[model samples]
Target chain A: MKTRAVILYGLLFLSVFLVLPWIGPESIDPGKIIQFLSGNNTPDGSIFWLQRLPRVILGLLAGGALAVVGAAFQVLFRNPLVEPFTLGVSGGAALGAFIAISIPKLLLTWGPFSTLQVLAVLGASLSLTLIYRLAHRQGGVSIYTLLLAGVTISIMCGGGILLLTYLSSPNALVVFQRWMMGGIDVVGFHELSALFPILLPGIGILFLHANDLNHIALGEEMALGHGVDVKIVQRDVFIGGGLATAAVVSLVGPIGFVGLIVPHAVRRLSGYDQRLVLIGSFFLGGASLAVCDALARTVLAPTELPVGIITALIGGPLFIYLLISRIGK
Target chain B: MNKPIIELRDIYYCYPDSEWELSLSGLAIMPGEVVGIIGPNGSGKSTLLRIAAGVLSPIKGDVYLAGSDLKQMDRRTIARYMGYLPQELISVYDYTVEDIVRMGRYPYIKGFGAFKEPDQRAVIRSLERTDLTEFKHRRLSSLSGGEKKRVFLASVLAQEPDILLLDEPTSALDIHRQVYFFRLLRELASDGLGIGVVTHDLNMASLFSDRLILLLEGKCFRSGTPGEVLDSSVLKKVYGDGLLLNKHPESHRPAVLPRIGPEKSS
Candidate 1:
């Protein structure tokens, strides 16, 4: 069953990337795109390979990572409504990036040791840790407290980012604004390489504990009786989920509903096996983001909208529909 | 037939602001014994079970499993020999019946890894035992209330513990399912597993249990066979109202039928 799902998803992914670029306009001609992919390229083909391909790949990776993280958080916290944005990791990452861009000199002085991605990851980790610690009451953390804490911290972090944006130089402000508005153009192999180490380990750990996570969803006492180290599982899930969310934010800005929508869609298809959910979430998320990115690039031709705008535009109505349907059920 | 599998020594637990600590000075549960713990709400029946299951560490005293102190043993090691089902049923994911049942093999599996062949067989066997084989692929949310209870019971059964502890396992079930489940528990106890069930149904407890422990105000009000513990005076002491106690016609087990309000009684 798993093998079949993987194969089907792989074909879907291939067709999306391979077919969509060909159907576009002269600037992104299908033949040139193919030639560029095959390593025999014109200037236009080179542009597509270097610029468009990286953006697409990054969107796929970031989307998959974010969706898995959101799914993990929902399970770990035992709340169906939890998502990357709700957990404050995105806001924390934006603050980190805002700080990094505003103080480029301060960052540069660290001797090639500074990057927006690293800062974003650090900020996300710290904020998430703080939220976890604060939300914990007695021996356990309540989902309600965690959600409230996440929202509170996110608001605070957003305020800080706004302050930083206002105080920054116009050039820095322009860069930060574009990044915050959710540009896919900045992603490249270098950023992807930076993202791989943290994202891969975090995701691997989550998948490893998928069974325990399933037990946890039953409740803490039952999970412990089943021999789960509840505290360790909780810590690992928070850190891993936070890191994965941060990785995506660092790359593509906070591309909204992929994490929220993909997991919900996958859950409807995959039942409740966390292993299948995790894997299926990766594919669904990647496909969703790829479709969104394709639309973002092509919908207006010469003038492309921010990928975040596209996701929100598409995601809002879908989210509302899901909300109403869930309530009805 | 065998040494006691669980022994509680001077166990005392107090909720944060409670005036008095719930105390069980000494309690011993032998292998294959079906013990029913009965009390009103807030009488500490569930609390005692939680202490026995190691979900809550008693403020004072020790719990011994197989004569070894539970505090000394790791939680996972203790879990291997004990299964606990809490009062509430909250399944976070929409896991299938089989997947939920397989969770019982969690302790045996290493480091949250994939299930082994033995785990798979145990899960299948448990599903069969619970009569949930046909519903194995169905999502939990799709199951009826009775079905969900059975699935949860199946999950605990899959744990294959030598000792089973349940808190109000049948409180949410209909009368028919409750009777069916109590019969099932009796069968399991006959198979040499020590079972401790906390419940409010004195009749069912008397019918199925080999011994009964009546808790009132954080202490054992009475402990004996159902015939001795289910008397009118004890019922009056535990619950305010005096009730008539008699043997059921078919089962010849003690059953209590409390009087209703004054108008109905008159």
Candidate 2:
């Protein structure tokens, strides 16, 4: 089981991780690929650095962070269907992105970050803070109450986005619509630097709590007996998961299914140990999303389909298969 | 003699947003003793065990582990000395027995730490103690009701705690395993660990326990050797009328007889 798991994860990683950045719409020659990568003379130099590699890394970070947080959410809530968006962070970020694109007044850009991205993080933190305040009771955070609060906030955000979508001008509406469709399309090093600060540490915190997450899935009372500080774990994960989700969603509009499916896929491939599940989700989530994003670029060629579209297309069917196979077990 | 390993004093708990009031005035567990907590359903046996194990906080009163107040200590510190087994377990997850047993070592390992030799040895010893050494790699979903219980028991044992608080450890066990479980507790106690077992099986409690504490209506009704506590008249009050009890022929401990007819009305 040990070696088999490693090999399976390795194959998945290599197949997608190796082939994705190179096989875009403008295929870089192997000769040119080396020159551009090694910082030498190449006509396609800016294209490789500015477009392809950043997009690939964006997909990797976005997918890895979402799935990692999604895995953490599943363990924290003890529910299989709970995704990264279960806490309303995506809703908040989506509304922020929508407002930035649609509203004429608030559309401002900062160095290495846009007004939208900052607002998205702010919105996500706001929702998370609200959830934490509402869920805390009797010296404990009730997960059910947190979930209900998240759902309520998500519903409110959804309505707000719909209202803004209706009020925007036709031209701005089109841009907003495309942005809502979601893609891992980054143009330069600024977006990468912006994402790195938030996502890396958030994912690292989740990785540290991997074992504790396993204990939590047993039950809060049971986890406490196992020496987990249930309240602190709850708070840390909410903040960590919220920050990661916000960071990615603000950069590339919310990519669905990676967060929900990767954890289930990893669990099905491996076992229910969160230590393995967390690590596996990161690898498989990044790989799966990278592969899908690759298809989004190549399948449509010059048109450039959104990566989110491909993710749902591939992930929806894959999840169905996983669900059936899991049921069979 | 010396301070008990686990001591509960004046603990009061009423379920949050519920009317159920449960309390424990005082309880103690010393090393090298197996204390059985026996009572009818709804007598708060589970709650008492949870309070003592530091899983549930009491509104009023203090729980001191060894000599220190548990409130001041972190869960990790309390967990090093105490392990709690829940009454009902969900075994649908695809975790290996070894994976679960390995979790018992969590409190000892710092964050981002991997298992070392001592940790692995503790897991192996725990598996052996619960007689699940052969089932280490087996999935929990593949095990039987009784075998799954052993897997959980092995996990708690892997913690290597000085005190164990077990809620209904025997409820899901077969007769042989139930006897085996009691014997295991006896063996562990002899090695100088303390155990508190909550059980409905009066007869099994009588057979293995050094002493028995009978709980009724959220209070300690009686606490004494099995011969003193497991009497027919005492059980009649707790059970409310359907009581037929006698001494075991082999062990000479009290045994409850099956209700032969429609249970005597309360």
Candidate 3:
């Protein structure tokens, strides 16, 4: 089973990196792709390079980051259902997006992220910090406390989002609604470039804690007995998840289930060694989101559906299945 | 003079949610012996092991590991000298037997580290000791309750500590496995490792342990050789009535048998 998971996952992952970029709104000629690669510029090269390529890469990174972060949170909290979204990070990012849209667009870009993207990250970081504080003040952050605090913070942010949406004029409403229904529409390499620096380190830190995570998976008390610094690791991992999820949510608009579903699928497919699960979550998540985006782009042809909806449309059934199975069990 | 592997002095511990308080002036485990703790439920037997393992801190006490204070030493340092096995396993992810055992080497491993040759070798050694070398590749979920217990025991053995603290190590095992496990502990103890086991099986405790500490209401009610500690007078005080006693035919060690009748006790 472990061997099959690796092989099937590798094949699926490779298919996206090799094949999915070929299908988009405007189909690029394979001949043109070869010519562009060979340094002979084709007429469709800019459309392919500046638009399609960055978007695919962004989908890969965003999906992979969310899933890895999800796996980390699951292990840290000792609950399989925990994802960045459940922890109120997406709520924070959603609030940031709402705030960014409430005011007129600011002409600012940090590295590759827009001023709006930066605000979403800052908002996510702030929200997680608040959640962390609430959980930590009681001493040793138990899983129940974390989930409770997360839901409370998320509800609070939801209230804020409701107020912002209520005050919006019809003109702002459509744009706000579109942004809220996230899509991977990187206009150029700039946004992708900005995300790489933040995403890479965040991903690296989470992956590096696989052993500690393995101990933590048994239980927090067990982890401490195995010589883990539970308090420090918990704090650092929460920040790491916040940083990565914030970066992805800033640009991709809280693309749900990548974190929630991908890590889960990886663990079920492979065994529960964090060393395997984290890396598998990265590749599988990247490929899965890329496929979702591809379906979003080609399904409507000229009109595009938000990639987030496409993911939800597919992943929602998995969630219900999990619920039914849990109830049945 | 040979230093005791672990020593506790002037220890006071309390649970925040409960009214229980435990205060002990001193308890120590020397190298090369097995010490058994027998207590009623909530008598702080498990709590003592947790404090000694550095999983919990006493309100006021000094814990010495090889002459260094436990509070001053980091968790990794404490783990280096001592290994602890809890009463039961947590709800774990799908992990192979080998994967669970290898986690015992976490203290020796560094940041994002690969399992080195020594780590793998230690895992193999532990698997061999626990009679689980053949089952190393099996999934933990598929194992029976007792086999899973051995897998966790293997994980602790892989830690290769100077001392072992086990809570109820024989609860789920068959009689044969329980005897086997205790024999293994005796062998390990004779090899210069201090072992402290907290269990409710008075018969096995008397048979295997070099010394016994009987606890009640968070205090050590009796501490001596098993022969002295397992006396009928002490058993009656700790366990109340309906108690009968026998002896192991081969070892001639005391075996406790409890009789239950409707009118025996309230």
Candidate 4:
């Protein structure tokens, strides 16, 4: 069954890769799309390779990261509603980027510190660490406390960012606005390099504990009876899950809906085995984001809608459907 | 034949910093004893069982397993010898019956853990013993309350522990399932496993238990065989008046019958 899910994911990826270049704004001809892949250079092929390829790859990576983080957070909190953004990690990153943009004097004096992406990563990491510490009692983090803390911190950070935006110079405000509306076009090799090491290990840690996470859903007392160290599992899950969310936010701002929607969809298709759910989430997440990114690029033609907007448009209805179905059940 | 498996010495426990305390000055449970602990609510029945199972550390005194202090043993190591089935059986995941039962092997399997052939066999045997083999693949959420209780019992049985500590094992079962479950526990005890159960049903405990420990006001009021502890005087002291204790005509065991209050006497 797991093999079948993987194969299906692979086929989906291949199909999307094949369809994206031809259906985009410039509409690289089918022949050129094929030729570009075969390493043949035509003028039409260069446009496909240069512009669409990076954006598609960025979408796939960001979507997969968000889905995996969402699944991890759901298991960590033992709540189906938990997602990457719910825990203040995304808000912290947004605030960090907002700060970096609003203060040019600070940026000039510390050139390396001026990168919005770096500031976002640092801000998310710090906020998540604080949340973990504050919510933990006797080596365990309660879902209720974690949720409350996350909401409080997120509101505070979000409000701070708004204040900073109001005080910023007009040019800085424009940059901040663009950054807030997350997109896939800005990912460079350097950002990917910095993110790859952290994201890869973080996802690996989650996969390794897939079985343990499944046991945790049985409630903490049962998990402990099964010899699982509940406190240790809780701490490690938060840190690893937080890092994955922070890494993705560092690259594409905060892509919504992929995390919130993908894992729930995968669970409906696959049984509630964390091993299957975790892997399935990655594939479906990547596909969902790729499809959304393609629509974002094509719907407005050259205008390129924000990826966040496309996801929200699709994800909001899906979320409502889930809520209604769950209540019915 | 073997050293007493578990011993408690001068143990004292209280909810943190509270003046009220639950104490067991000295207690020892030997192998193959079916001990039933009965008490009113808040009489420390659950607290004593938790301490014995090593789930809660006593405020003062020592717990020993095989001559070593419980505190000195790793949590997993102690868990290997003790199987605990808490009162609530709420599960987070919708695991299949087999998957839930297989968790019992967790303490036995080593690092890079995979359920081995022995573990599989144990899970199968547990399911069979609990009469749940037919429902092995069913999700826990779909099981009836009695069936769910058996599944949880099967999980503990899969652990293959020397000592089984259960808190209210039959509290919520229908009368038929309660009798069946107590019979199962007696059978397990006969197979040489020590069993300690906390229950409110004194009649059921009297029928099944080899020994009964009656507790009141946070102390053991009487400890003896069921015949010695289930008398009218003990019942009147532990519980209030207006309860009658009589010998069942067929089984010849003690039975409890509720009577009207003295004020209702016309």
List interface RMSDs for the candidates, in order: 1.7, 1.8, 1.6, 2.2
Better of 1 and 3 by TM-score: 3
Candidate 1, residues B1-266, lDDT tens digits: the string is: 58888999999899887696799888888888999999888889999999998888899999999889998887678878888888887887677888788888877877545678888888988898888999999988899888898898888888888898988999878999999999889888888999999999999999999999999889998999999898887777767664678889988888788665653221
Q: Using alpha carbons, what is the TM-score of model 3?
A: 0.92
Using lDDT as the measure, the top candidate is 2
Candidate 1 residue A273 C-alpha distance from true site, Å: 1.7
Question: Each prediction's Cα lDDT score?
Answer: 0.81, 0.83, 0.83, 0.81
How do the residues B193-232 of candidate 4 rate in per-residue lDDT, one tens digit apiece? 8888999998898888888888886788898888889899
> Where is the poorest 10-residue window by lDDT in model 2 chain A?
A1-10
Residue-by-residue lDDT tens digits, candidate 3, B218-238: 988999998788788877777
Q: Is the docking of candidate 3 incorrect, acceptable, medium or high quality?
A: medium
Better of 1 and 2 by lDDT: 2
Question: By DockQ, highest first, what's the ranking?
Answer: 1, 2, 3, 4
Q: How well is each residue in A187-240 modelled by candidate 1, as lDDT tens digits?
A: 555556767778888888777777677788898888877778787788788778
Best by TM-score: 2
List, residue by residue over A139-165, the lDDT tens digit for candidate 3: 366667778988998899999988988
DockQ of predictions, in order shown: 0.66, 0.59, 0.58, 0.47
Question: TM-score of model 1 relative to the true fold?
Answer: 0.90
Worst 10 residues of 2 chain B by lDDT: B87-96
In model 3, how large is the Cα lDDT of residue A15?
A: 79
